[model samples]
Target: MAWVKWDQILLPYDYGGLNVSSLKLKNYSLLTKWWWRFLTNDNALWVRVIKSIYGQSGGLGCNSPLPATKMKIFSGRNWSQIINIDQTPSKLGCNLSNVFVKDVGSGLDTSFWNDIWIGDLPLKDAYSRLFRLEVFKDATISDRITITFDSPVFSWAWESQPTWRTEDELASLTNIIKLHKFSNNSKASWTWKHNSNGAFTTDSLMQVLTSLTAAKLPPSSATDLSPFVPKKVGIFIWRAKKNRLPVRVKLDRKGLDLHSTRCPVCDDDIETLHHSLISCKFASNIWDKVRRWWKFNQLHLTNLSDIASCSNPKLVTTLGVSIWQAVVWVTSYYLWIHRNNCTFGKNIDSAAKIFSDIQGKCFEWINCRWRKGALDWLSWITNPCRFDSIFTKNGIG
Candidate 1:
């Protein structure tokens, strides 16, 4: 009799003819037919299940769908009251079955449920809908249930399971983690290694060392001694002479007296290399005119070092070096030319005219070859007013 009642609860409303109530229930077939028609007619399938399970427990009276609430219960707490609160059977059944089936699949038979569930919320879907209403309700009350039944229940309803990564793939991930770790620890050294091929062989390294050492010294006493010597010595030799200096006295195994060598520029003093290059009175006048053209006040310059270190603004540093070499070459060249001119009775330009000619040639070379582009040449040559007008007319304003 109890089994019959259980079967009555398990069976769909349309399938049964056995009378367990013994009340001689009339219109049973008609009622069953109508029940099926009502349950499956227009509502979502879960609503139909809810109606069937708890229809007699005032469940049908609630107009609204049950309010769903989620709460995470700690391991040791009573899960039933923590997760579900309604005294209503419909809400109670849904909440309980959902929680229990999820727990069973996740807790006991993980592999079984993992293989089967293939859609969203598969474990919850299986427990909620796979069984007949009576069996589902009974399972909610059951204390011992295997994950095998749960897997099939969830799988038959088609729910997605969580994916697990393989151990080998996880092992491969450690290489990237190690690379990031190395980057954080050795960033500066690694950057330098990449830039210099693990060797500091460039001029910039010397510059860096100079800057570090210079920081500890007074500005006036600090000097950068890194050599700027060019590979071609001929360029330096050519620029040392003005036109071409004559070889008058070749130095043999004989040492000449100071009085024997007379100044080529002025016959006043002994003409050693240093006196001819730097200390001559005639060369001083030429240098004074050149300095005036460059807008520096006349300072007594008695040596090559003074010319090398002079900070005249008009002499562009690079051009200054080139000009210095040119001056040295031209002076020797002019001295040779002057001697030949004097011996053969040929016309020679004065020292002032020669200096002016050097300046003109230097300007011509700068404008034509050394300047970067036509615009730069124009800017270099044009007056300020004309240059500004050209820029404004060209829409570069």
Candidate 2:
């Protein structure tokens, strides 16, 4: 749930979600860049300074020429954590190495087996049996590949003779290395695999971390939320569908000892996400008026999915679908906002007033963003579904 909040926050506002990032994820994402820099930017002065103290901090660490008498990393050294991201327990599921990969050039700065220089997973992970039998875990790519005139030579280190399953893993690993192209011309570097330019961005890393965690949750069906609606409205719809909305019933179910989980507005039913957003006496009346305004049939919605999918495809063309979706989403967002007002003792507008506000905001945003789809205020309020031309799905006129 927290990850989802951060995801929405990081989304561009016009994409119909919130702004800002979860500070923890943001910090971790930023820290990963230091690891990237240390792995690739060997000549940079800051990287050099760290190498002078940390004394070759193992595979994929700075490979600068030794300054002599360097000590192992000790406490109070801030970069130690970033250098060991692969071994760290990440709050965002997998660690930094999962999103980043090694781009071997001279291969001096990349781990031959531990770093993800060759395949999707590190050789240590993909060939764990062979990795277990290996003596040197910190062998760099340059240590394994050597250049002799025009051709390259490859070598390996083994603790003991291989046999059986270990032999099989060694066979597969050998086959992979045989196909790897090595050159001594370019410097080895690390790259963020997710981006086109092979560079790091906070947003790109956050997206990967979010995706890895999202898979553990139940799948959501709220895809294709309309671009016509406000970001808050899109985020609200997404959360509601995923059952992550902070309605009283859900909070109480999660062991929040509320005074009552009853509907915050009407106090007629437990304020489950569905009831709070759709079936509450207040929300139901608002929905009825909104349906009437859009010339939609008043179907009795029993679930959040029903309300979210209320716009009829058979009745509306492309242009009308966008407008209708915006109206429905705006209506839902205000209903939730009004519910919060009631719960917090804020000024709760009447159902009519809330509905009016929803209409006004929808018209303002839709017309402003969709120049080709602009509507007269009278016709927009009267019925937004009456479209005969300029029917593009993106809401552009």
Q: Which candidate ranks first by TM-score, i.e. highest?
A: 2
Put down candidate 1 lDDT per residue, 241-304, tens digits, no spaces.
Answer: 2112222232211343323355545767764544555566766666665555544565445554
Q: How displaced is residue 210 in candidate 1, in Å?
A: 24
Decoy 2 TM-score against native? 0.65
What's the lDDT for candidate 1?
0.34
Q: In angstroms, give how far residue 4 of model 2 lies from its true place.
A: 7.4
| Residues forming the 10-long window of minimal summed lDDT in candidate 1 | 182-191
RMSD to the true structure for each prediction, in A, is: 36.7, 6.3
Alpha-carbon local distance difference test for all models: 0.34, 0.69
- Candidate 1 is scored at a TM of 0.29
Model 2 misplaced regions, further than 4 Å? 1-22, 43-49, 57-73, 84-179, 184-207, 216-218, 221-229, 244-248, 251-271, 280-283, 297-300, 334-361, 388-397
